[model samples]
Structure formats: structure tokens, C-alpha cells
Target: MELSILIVDDDKLLVDKLEETVQWEKIGISMVFTAYNIRQAQKLLEEFPIQFLLCDIDMPQGSGLELLEWIRDNQMEVECVFLSSYANFAYAQKALRLSAREYLLKPISNQDLEAVLSRIIEETREKRERRSAEEQNLGQQRKGKTEFWEDFFRNPSEQERMLAQVLEEGFYQETDVLILEVIKIFADDKDINYKKDLSLFNFVIRNITTEFFENNEQVMEAVAQVSDYEWVLVFRNLGEEERFLEASGDLKKHLNKILPQRSCMYIGETRPLKETAVGWKQIEIMEKKILPGTDGILCERDISEQDQMLSGNAAYRLPPWEIWQKTLHNSEDLDGVCRNICDFLKETFAKGVLTIENLERFLRELEQLVYCYLGEQQMSFSQLFDSREFDRRERDSFHSLDAAVGFVEWIFGTIKGRGNSRRSQEDVVSQVKDYIEGHLNEELSRGILAKMVYLSEDYVSKLFKNTTGMSLPGYIANRRMEKAKDYLEHSSLPVSRIAMEVGYSNFSYFSKTFRDFTGMTPNEYRNHMTKNSSDKK
Candidate 1:
């Protein structure tokens, strides 16, 4: 494929020499375009579909830095290589800031120039393939129903224009864009892991894109990134200001669900995208004040509201543990202790940005304490609930706490109830043991015992194991083997019928367990018992 090169320099003689002597055609460069200043370069950028831009930093009209700034502002896809004569570190540093691909000092060597050209040639080949795929995406974009994000990355300029056009096609022809930034704050000690950060970026992006796609098919196009350990979700909105606010609130809820365990998200409010320069100006200011700045999606309103609430004061509150520990003594009131502990937890959740996991730890520890208290006094939460005999009106209050505290509290409470239930829970176990011994020929699962005792299969299984050191099946097998031996010694029952009399429908499983428990199988033991009985007779 033929390569195109654009050289921006005011040195007529040097340009002539480089143009004539170099085998540009041999290296695959076919057409070359020249621009003397930043103005001419801007015109060339708009008009010609040039591949490589080799520009001198010090130009007569305007420097290459100004041209680079323009490219960044317009979101243009271009790789720049800087050229300058004077040995200035500051200029090179500024060039690096602009993301210049390479820096070369001007008294240019043909060999170094050739090397740069070769590198550009290789890069352009890849760019050509990317450009081809981008064109295909552009074709898809014209269909109006394709995924906006896929096309958005390929042609950002076209996407911004299309979003504007679609909004015009819709209710409002004139609209302002709001750029909201979401920052996530992490634990201070550890540096952010990149892979995890990227995963978070993808997760939040999926949420934002899905939410927008669900609500507004036209105006709410968005993009997300993980930059400097912060997850940034940028949205393009052209709807009512109130609608955007509502969307921001919904997005925050969405963020909560994705990383409920560890991250706290702070969202900034939507600002005018038209004023992108000003919006960018606010980015540093916003970053300075944002909480949970590392992983959250925060709008401008989030930061401003927090600022107003704190009123420029650094908000530092005591940890829940320290607060609970202070002015503490051995208190016998279980209800008072539980309330104090729960209040401490609630305060931590509100003020300290506790993750869902840490909140769960607090609940678990609290429940463990409750269980220890109950066990010492021989009582249960269920008994307390049942004794209250809460009317239908008061029952709703339980549901409210159940919902607010979430499934963790319910589980912890249930575990505590199970621990209390065990002391008086063996009546059913005794009955079950009697029934199993009486009916050895019948199938004896935890389910059957549960039915007999009026309990769940799971509860009965746990209860049986907790009450008896041996498992139900193991105890039943041992009992059946003992009965079979008695029948063999005293009665003239056939070995098969004796096996049937014992709990062996298959007899093989029974024999295996019997042999495993004792030294012999059921048949072998029965034969020995019969021989001994015959000898005694």
C-alpha cells in the first residue's frame, strides 16, 4: 500500500534536500504534503487524509505545540513526531505532555529521519487496518440501531455529531451537554491493582450503557475509563435537566450493586459538554474534593453537596469499635447492648464509608454476642418474637428492619436461634430413635424422621448429628446388625429373611456397613451365632 507523509517545516532548502535525495518511494511513501505553520497544518488536517505528521516545533506562524493542542481539543486521531533545532529540555518536556510520538533535534540526520519514516510506515499499516474497520463501523452506525459504544470508539467525532443530530431529530433542537465524573476511593495503604480497576471500569460502563439504552435510545450515549485508579463514566445527555438528575441518582444505585462489598462511589453532577474547556477546568478541582474518589461514579452535585455539608471542614469521625468501647462496662441489659451496638454500626455506615462486607462483619459479630448472651441465660430471639405475639400492625416493623438490615441479619438471627433450640431440641430425636429401632426394615432417612417429628429435613439432620455423636444412618446400621445376630442365634429364620428383617432392602449396602462396623459381614456373623447356639444346645 502507498503511504502519505505530511512534513510541517519552514526550512525551504532543508525540505527540498530531504524531498529530492531520500528514496521516499522505495520506502513505500508515495505522496508527501507540506505545511509551514500550525494554521496550514490545521487546514491540511481537515482536508487531506494524511497518514504521518512530521512537524517542526518552532515554526514562523505558530508552533507545533499549538497544533497538538488543537488535535487533542477536537479529539482528532493523529500521531505527532516533534522536530526542533535548539537543545531545550523544557520544549521536549512540553512535547511529551502533548503525547508526541517522538522527539528529534533539527540538524536532522538522513539515517535518523529514515528510521523515523520506517517506524511511521509500520504504524500507518496498522492504522490503515483500523481505519478500514472503522469505516465498516461507520456503515453500521448509519443503520441507527447498532451498538453506539462500538461505533463511538472508532469515530468519536462522528458519534458526538450523531448524538447532537439525533437530539435535534427528537424533541429539542438546542441542547447542552453535561460531563459527570465518578471517583472511587480505596483503602489508603495499598496501591490500586490495574486489572481490578479495569474490571471495575467495564462493570460501571456496562451499568451506565445498559441504563441509558433502557431509558433514552437517543441522547444518552456514554463512555467509561479507569484513569489514575479512578473509574470515569462520561455521558452525553440532551434531555431535560431534571431527567438527567434522575438518571444520575439511578446510576448511583446501579454503582452500589456492582461493588457493594468494597467500593464507595462519589458522583459529580452533569455539566455542559459544550463548555468542555471549562468542564475540564473543573476536573482537577472536583478530583481534589471527591470522596471514595478511586472507584465511585460521582456527579458535580455529589461533591458540591458534600462540600456544603462539611462547609470546608475535614470530617473525621471515630471508628465504630472505638466509639462502642469508650465508657463501656459489663451491662446485663441485652436489649440495651444490642441497640447501642446497632446504633454504632448505623453511624459507621453513614459516616465512615463502610463497605457492605465490613457492615456484614459488624452484624455477624453483634449476632455472635447476642447468641453468647442467650446461651448463658437459656433463651432465643424466636422465643422473644413469639412471646411478643406481635399483631399484624407491629409485624410490619419487623419486615422493615429485616429489609433494612438485609439477609445477613436474618441469617445471623437464625443461626443464633438454632444454637438456642438445641438444648430442648432432643425430644424429637428420642422419638425418632425409638421409631428407627422398632422399624429396622423401613427406610430411615432424615426426611422420614423429620416427618415423624414435624420438622424440616435439614433441621432434623442437623439435630440428629448434634444430639448423637454417631450419624443417624451409622446408628441405624449398628442397631440392625445387632438385631440380625439375635435372630440368627434364637430363631430359625433363613439368612435372606433375617437380612430382610434387618434394614437391608438390597442387603449388600447393609453387609458393607456391618462389616465396616464389626469384624464380619451379616451372613458370616449370623452363621457363627447359629453354630455357637447349636453347640450350646
Candidate 2:
């Protein structure tokens, strides 16, 4: 491939010197573009097929960091290196966050510049080559393997035929021992739309799983997305089971860091090629029995103990919902009532007697009690909680004991808040607004803010909207955009820095939000303010 590079610096002399001194053609750069400022750089970036960017961090109109942030927001894939005279750690940190290739000091020697360019060229080439290889491999081998597994799992009657065909095609051997590993993805965070992004998430997860096991010589791995949030990894040939388990633990940790959702991995026992279907079924059963938030690597033994405890145990019983309901109605001490419920749940969890069945029944009984109480007050559940959020919380409550307790507490607290006077309601809203104002630079979610004021997220959201004439999220976005505009007009901070100041870690998301709010990008907004100021002067 013909490689191209763009040189951006406000210093005309430095730009001229680098362009003249660097042997672009000798170092495999087929084209070189020069720009004096961020605007010029952005125009050239839009117009040309530049593969690499050699930019100065400091510029007059805008910093290179701002330009890179724009490039990222536009989804442009360009390798970048920053050149700065000062060894400022803040600048370096920003550059790193922007995925810059390297940070070099100014007055760079020709030899050093050439070496950096050559290394970048090689790395880019390798990446493209690897991507091409992956595409071809996916087209050829992965399709067949995935199709085979799908047939084997979905059509039990054809499992034998599929296995025979794969064995005949050398995809697997009769002598090989196979192990099935299943990864179940859960949308642990309320903000994640699991169904909407399941395909993309599955693709990324499959790639990560493939790469992690690529170096292992003991097993030949094949990964398939068998369901919306579940992936099945089939490992061929027998190896050290302990080693595989250790690696599975590491893979779980790696995935937890990289993936936005939580995942649980189940490793099935080794089986012959013919019994692969059975092994897959065993893992599926294990998955259904395990709780939602049960993360980490689970093995056959783990599932067996869980099955025994769930089926054989009869000592676990539901919480005393009838008495709790009477207490809630007769007592003015709502906090004490909530405390008692949480305490019971904590004690049950500590005893390890909290089975999923009993926990679910307890939740059902609690909901009934709450509904009956609300009916007595001529109020409905929908009036206090958003139906969708309520359903999500109920599903999440099944994940763990802590989650169940939290749901119970949130429910009772919400009911308590409903009985409060108008003045107290206004006070809660005031507290939430104050919290939002003070923590604009930190992450502010409805759940966090609601917890701070001891109310349900739905109740707080409705109160904020009723009091402020805007939804809670809408208010936060407006405040953030307003702060960003003030900074753009008054300070010389980079757009990325402004984004961080407004509680946005992602420059692209921040820019998109800003544009959505103001109908102009941050740079455009800043330029507009500048033009208006000049006109007034």
C-alpha cells in the first residue's frame, strides 16, 4: 500500500524544515501534506487519504489535541505522533488518551523522525495484514465451523450427521476429546441496551476469546455465538485441565476490563467428538440454574453443588412479607422497617440458604404487599415507578443477595417518600439539584443521585422534572453544554479538556452531545463566539 503522512505545526519554519529534511520517499511515505493550523489540518485530513499524522501539540488557533479529538469524533482512523517542546505530563496524558502513536520532543533529529515513521509504517502494515487475514479466515473456516455447531446444537437429530461431516472434513477427529465452554453475557448496568448491541458485543467478544486462546497449543478452539448473549467455545484435544482453568480465570478478568457488560464462563467436562452435543447441553443446564450476577469461571463441580443445594434443601423459606406489610402500615418508623428487611436478606445470604426459587417467591410476595398497600392509598405502582425501570430492577434483583436487598430498600424508601409532605418533596429536589451542580466534573447518574437523597431513581427523576420543568437527564445535558460553552468562550482549554470538565470521558460522545444541544460542534461554537465578540468590539 502507498503510505501518506500529514505534517501539522503552527511554526512555519519548523514545518518547512521537517518537510525538506525528512526523506519521505526513502522511508516509504508516498505523499506528504503540510498544514499551519488545526483548521488547515482538518481540511487536509478531510480531503486527502492521509494514513499518518505528525502534529505539534501547541498551536495558535487550536491545539493538536483538539484536532485529534475532532478526528476521533469523525471516526477517522489515523496514526498520530505529537511533537512538543515542553515535556508536559498533562499534554502527554491527553495525547495518550487520544491514542497517539508516540510523543516526541521538539527539535527532533532527522534520524529519530525517520525511525519513528518507519516503525509506524511497519506496525500499520502488520495491522492491516492481520485484519485481511482475519477476514479471509472468517470467510472460509469460521463460517463452516459456526454452521456446524449451530446445526449440531439446534438440530439434535442431525447432530450425528454434522459431527460425521466435520470429522470427514478434518475439522475434528473421532479420537479428539472436546470441551465446551460457554460465556453468558449480562447487562449488569441499566444503561446498556443488551438486545440492541448484542451482535457487535458478540463479535468483539469472539475476537477476544480467539486471540486469548490462539497461543495455547494444548487445544484447538472454535467459538460460536449460539444465542443473543451466550457464546459457545469448543476446544478440541485433551490438555492440562488445571492450566485451562487458570487461563479461563485470566480470560474472565481480561474480559471484565474490556467488555461493557458482565460475563460468566462455564467450562464443561471433556467428552469425545460424538458426545460434544451432550457436553453443550450440560453447559446449558448449568447456565439456567446459576443466578444472573454469578460472574467468574464456573466448572462442573460448582454447578453440581448449586443443583444439590437448590433441589435437596427444604429449610430455606420466604421472608415474612405479611408481618412486614402490617408493620409498614402501622409504624411511622419507615427506615427501621427497611433496615429489618435488609438485615433479614443479609442474614439469609450469609447462611447460603437463599435459593433462587425462594428469593423469587419472596420478591413476588413483597410486590403483592406493596401493591395492596398502594391500593389502600388510592395510588398505583405506575404512579411512583416507571414500568420499564421497575421491570429491569426486578430482573436485576435476581442477580445477587445485595441486589435483592437494594431493590427492597428502594421500594420501601420510594413508598415512604410518597407519604412525605410537599415541603419535604421540594427539599429532596433541591438536594438533588445541588448535588448535580457540585459534581458536574464527576459522573452523575440518576441512581447515584437518587441514592444520595435516599429516594428511588424514578421518584427523584419525576420530582426533578416536575420542579425544574425538565427531565433529570435533560437537565444534566443542558448544564453540561452550558458549562462547555462558557469554557469555550472564556478559556483556552482544548475541546477534550472541556469534555472532561463536563463529566464526559469520551470526546466523541461529548462532541455529539454538544452538537445535539447547540446545533454546532464545539470548535464551530467557539468560532461563532469569537466572531460575535469581534463584531461587538
Candidate 3:
């Protein structure tokens, strides 16, 4: 997800060698992606944050130059260095036209590559700084009282400390604070898009609320934007509870005339300046308990009912996701574990014992835990989740308490689906592995291996890569070399015989492969093992 570099080449062997020899981490790059062709490289570019591309000029299916063209066409911000085997002036001219970092001839030295990369990294850093400066300039333009209020709630006491300076030029009663939670407001069918017309939405919420309460003789009111979706209004010198609440009821009627949601008046309890922030937090936390269509003015006193419900019973409370994670890890009791979780969720959401906020919070935490566990296996969550679109109904909010029950059950089913796919992948890889071990003395070409597993060569290759992060050829080579090492160390067989045993007819070629794999020739490895055995004796 962080900054990375991608290396694309049609020659898998060349790709392997380049990856093995490159000191990517030493050159301040921790992530380097490799692809055999342009399509795979394009997918990586879309999903991951790639800063640079070290791509060969020619590849199968699509060339690196074509990939560069696609990147430029998209106006994507990625620096590319072209690697070509030829010294064609036409290619050079095209590379220059595409604004490539450099057109490097094949067989460039590592030092030269490193030097080129260092320059690119410097340029990348400068590009990032320039972008950050531009964003900061825009942020400064947007910064004002709204930004101040957002910061104030995060560190309430500290911001309250700045009250004096803020009020030096302007005056207000900072004693009583009202935190208002704004949900969606649909104005009219054609002009009611909040996402597209966010400024208009913001204007209606703030400007209207300010005008409604500004000149009330009982209160000196000041409202400021707390977040994009919420605002805080501070009222001063307002005394009686009944009269204030009556005024609030009238205020709600006015708000309803212009807004969509009746719960827009979701207000916090009045508090002194020292305790006002506590009031703000209380209102937000209490909002989690408010059911849709069952609302009036919500006060701190309304929270006690939900608190009593949760504290009164274990099944009524939020599920502990960490415990579920442990259960999923050693999932002998998966059905029972999931069943219990779902039953409790049914009781919580279906019975209206938990608030929407808590339900969402719990579900989000559950998703995060699943993501963390899968990420450790080098699995992609978006790849797993986004590819499978949920039914449109599943995307909507729980309209009824019974619907909320169904929502929680659906979440467990989704997780189980992920687990099932993981199991299926393991089974496929396991069968292929069995074939590999049984046919170690025979040719294990991708074609041969794919037939053994009843899959096409390309399918087998992709499956192996997805499961083990190893190309079919790379994995087969690793297996062969591992067998060779074991034979050299533990058996009295000649190097030639051992090479043949590992399915290599040419002993010299086998020796070269062994050296490439382990940095030692077969005979040298045998000698080293004999010397070590003697020393041990």
C-alpha cells in the first residue's frame, strides 16, 4: 500500500535474476513488484501505490512501451525507466517522447542501475513535497472556524484554553455546548445529492441552525461545524429546562421543514464550560442507542435505559472479536463459535438492545481482524471482497429490527465464505504438491504438472503463484535444487548420478543450476559437507 517500484519483463528467468540481484531495500525501496507482461503490471499499478516502473521494452501479449503509453494516457503519476535489448534510435526517440526516466540498454551494470534509481528516488521525493505543499495551500484556504471546532472536540480542554483568544474579537457564551449529529438530508429528487453538492448541504445545516437560534432573548447561541456531518452549538444564559425543551421542539419543527431526517435535532445535555466537552461525547455515544423513527429530543437521561439493557445481560452486549479470531485460527469449533456469535447478534440487533453505532463498530472491528489475519498470509482483502458484489439489499441499512438480525447473520456467512475459499485453495495446492513429490525423478514441466492435476498449464501456474508466491518454474527449480542438496550431503552417490536422479541428464547443466540456486556447485557442496562431517567427528 505504501510507495513501491514495479519490474516487468517477458523473460521469467530474467525477472527472477533481476529480483535476486537487486538491492532494493538497501536503496530505500522496501516494496518491488514483478510482472511477466503489461497486463499483470497494469493490475498492480491500479491496486498498489507504485512510484516507479523498471520495465523491459518488449514483452509477450503487450510491450512495456504500450504499458507506458497507457499510464500516460491515464495521466497517472509514475516514473518509468525503459529497459531494451536493442539500440534502436527510433525506440530511443519514442522513449524520449513518452517522457521516460531513461532508455537503458540491456546488460547495464548494477551500479549504473542503482545510480539511476537514486536520481529517480530524489525526484520522487521532490514530487511528493510539491504535491504536499499544494494540498497545504488548499487546506489553508479551507481552514477557518470549522477547522478550529473540529480540533477543539478532539482535545477539548486544550481548545477550551484558547477560548479567551478566540473571543477577544468576538463574544459568545461558551458555557453550554450542543453537539448535533447530521445524517443525510435529501432536498429534492434532482438536486439532492449530498456527495456532489456537499457545500450546499453544509450551508443548509449550519446557516439555518444559526439563524433559528441566533436572536433568542433567553440564549446567546453560536454554532460551528464539528465535522462534515456534524455541528456543535453553544448556548448562553438559557435557564429553565421546560421552556428550553419547548423551544427545541419548535426548533425541530422548523428543521424538519427543510431537512429529511427527524433525528437531526440529536442534541447533547447542557453543561458548564468545564464539562461541556463531556456533554458532546455523551451525546455522540448515546446516539448509538437511538432507533430510527423512534425519536424526539434525546438527552443524557435516555442513555441509562440502553446501558441498563447491556449491563443487565452478557448476551445483550457487543461480541468480543478477538475471541472469535482465536476460534477461527484453531477452528475445530467453527460452526459452534459462529452460531453463538450470530445468536448473540440476533439478540442484540433484532431485540433493539444495541445501538446502530455499536453494531457498526463491532462489525468494522470484526472485518479488520479478518483482514489482519489474511494479510499475514499475504492475501488481499479487496481482491477477496470487492470481486464478489453483494446483493443490493445487503448494502442497505437495517430497516427493521428483524432486518438487523439478518445483517449480522450475513456478516458471519461472508467470513465463512472467505474461509471456504481459503480451504479450497489449500486443497488444490496440496494435490499439486503430492504430484510433485511422486514425480521428482520425472520431468516436472508446467505442462506435465498441469496434466497431473487436471488443470491447464496457465491455470496451474497462476494457482501456484497465488497460493505460494512462486511461479511454476521457480517452484519446480527450488524443489529440484533442494533434492540435489539433500543427496549431496547425505548420500555417497556421484554428482552425475545425483544430477540424473533429480531429472537432469546433463551433469554440467545441473551443477550450474545448483550454483545459481545455492551459490555453490554440487561437487563443492559435497566437499563442504564432508569437511563439516569430519570436523563434527
Q: Give the TM-scores of the predictions, in the order they appear.
A: 0.32, 0.55, 0.32
Off by over 4 Å in 1: 1-178, 181-208, 211-214, 217-220, 223-232, 237-239, 248-266, 271-300, 303-336, 343-412, 419-537
Q: Each candidate's root-mean-square deviation in Å?
A: 23.0, 14.2, 23.5
In terms of lDDT, model 1 sits at: 0.59
Task: Judging by TM-score, tell me the better candidate of 1 and 2.
Answer: 2
- In terms of lDDT, model 2 sits at 0.79
Better of 2 and 3 by lDDT: 2
Per-residue lDDT over 1-537 for candidate 3, one digit per residue giving the tens place of the 0 to 100 score: 256789999989888887889888777787889999888999999998888999998666987879999999988889999989989898888888999989999998888998899888888888888999997975564455456556676676686565555556453345534433333332222334656555755776667655665444443244556555555655555666567666666766676676543224555555665555566666655544443322334545444544643243323365777787777677635566667766776566446555655555665665676577667656555434432122222333323344445555655565555455554667878878888877777888876665454444566677789999998778777888999999999999998999888889988899899999889989899999999999999
Per-model lDDT: 0.59, 0.79, 0.67
Ranking by TM-score: 2, 1, 3
Clashes of each: 25, 0, 0
lDDT of 2 at 455: 52
Quote the positional error of residue 329 for candidate 1 in Å: 10
- Which residue pairs collide in model 3, if any? none
lDDT, model 3: 0.67
